[model samples]
Target: MKQICVFILVLMLTSCEYFNVKKTSSEAILNEELQTFNWNDVDVYPTFSVCDSNETKNEKTACFTQVLTTHILGYLQNKSIVVTHDVTDTISLKFQVSETGMLSLLNIEADSLIIKEIPHVKELIYCSLDSLPKVFPAIKRGQQVKTEFELPIIIHAN
Candidate 1:
């Protein structure tokens, strides 16, 4: 009788459905989703009116930069700021384009002599940037985003 009772108890425990567990596929699903995720690289470069009709990304970027450089240089040259005493130097200006297509000056780097010689250099840079044509901000993941630009201004004094 004891042996028969032990056998019955073991059978009852094994036959219960509560002891069964199933594996979930969450790991596999997560891996698949990650494979389809898009990285944050810019899909489109910022555009100026001169670059608006460009067909390719590289062309648009190049044209935009060239046009911007021309505008800034034109302003400086017109103001007679590039004339110096036989010294050649480069001033690096960092700026940004907002999502709403406005230019803002961020920072500028120049030599001590250049800083002393150039009156209100920051103001001049701000004015130049303010004079730029409206831009179409860079696009990332199909949304407009602010972008930074670094421009090198080379002053060649003869």
Candidate 2:
């Protein structure tokens, strides 16, 4: 009887041994990775992947501005995109993201052929970072969080 009990105990221990434990669901994993996705381009700031701690508002603003501006300049620096030295206008870009968290290039600059083809520019990646997913990182009880951000870009040619 003692041998039988010992055998049963050993069997129970071996059967109960865990291989691996997965607490997070598939949806949770997909959502987390989707929220923290990295872009193909490295110049764009304010990306979901480019959050900087202890950064001042001015620093953030400057970083994003420089990123977008440099990208645009790189696209139009020497290439044959003719810009009117006299015509200067501030074009506003707005987007309406879908439930899947994607930045659809909603508004287009309908001024010229060059303007319309901006999306095709090698460096011209849309503001994917501006439209962050709802699954963005949430601050803990004592952690600092950014409440609001204005992802605006301005282009100038002179």
Candidate 3:
């Protein structure tokens, strides 16, 4: 009876180890979370103060676009650009908004003809960007993140 009791106690202690759950490492959990996370999507887009905060994501986006376009167009319109030939082209502006809400030009895509016609076109764009209203940085996973934008502006001057 004494031997049987000892064997039973040993079996019970060893079986407890079998029922223990395996602990997951923090790095493994973080890796799994990152793999499931969508890197391309943002929780909130960069916005201007003029944009309504209560609006939906799509509305906020539209307001941002409209405000940005208006500001650029207004600046361009104020400039006295005189072209010899009827100039019509689409200018692609690539820019970035930093995590701190600063705007910086990345690249400008314009036809050679447009460049020839408006020698200071790049300068004008830079000035316009500099004059933009205060912007709010985009948010991803509750953290401010930098975002890049490519805007196409159609220019028609006679």
Among all candidates shown, the one with the greatest lDDT = 3
Residue pairs that clash (backbone atoms under 3 angstroms), model 2:
none
Give the range where candidate 1 is weakest over 10 consecutive residues by summed lDDT.
79-88
TM-score-wise, the better of 2 and 3 is 3
Candidate 3 has an lDDT of: 0.90
What's the CA RMSD for each of the models?
6.8, 13.2, 2.7
Error of 3 at 114 (Å): 0.9
In terms of TM-score, how similar is model 2 to the real structure? 0.34
Q: Can you write out model 1's per-residue Cα lDDT over 1-158, one digit (the tens) per residue?
A: 99999999999988886777876699988898879876545688788887878899999989987888888778776776653556467989887878887777788888777776775666776787766888888888778888888888886545
Give candidate 3 misplaced runs (Cα > 4 Å).
1-18
Best by TM-score: 3
Model 3: pairs clashing at backbone N, Cα or C within 3 Å: none
Sort all candidates by TM-score, best to worst: 3, 1, 2
Against the unseen true structure, what C-alpha lDDT does each candidate score? 0.79, 0.46, 0.90
lDDT tens digits, residue span 1-158, model 3: 99999999999999999999999999999999999999877888889998956568888878888888788878988999999999989999897899999988899999999999998999998898877889999999899999998888888888
Q: How close is candidate 1 to the true structure, as a TM-score?
A: 0.70
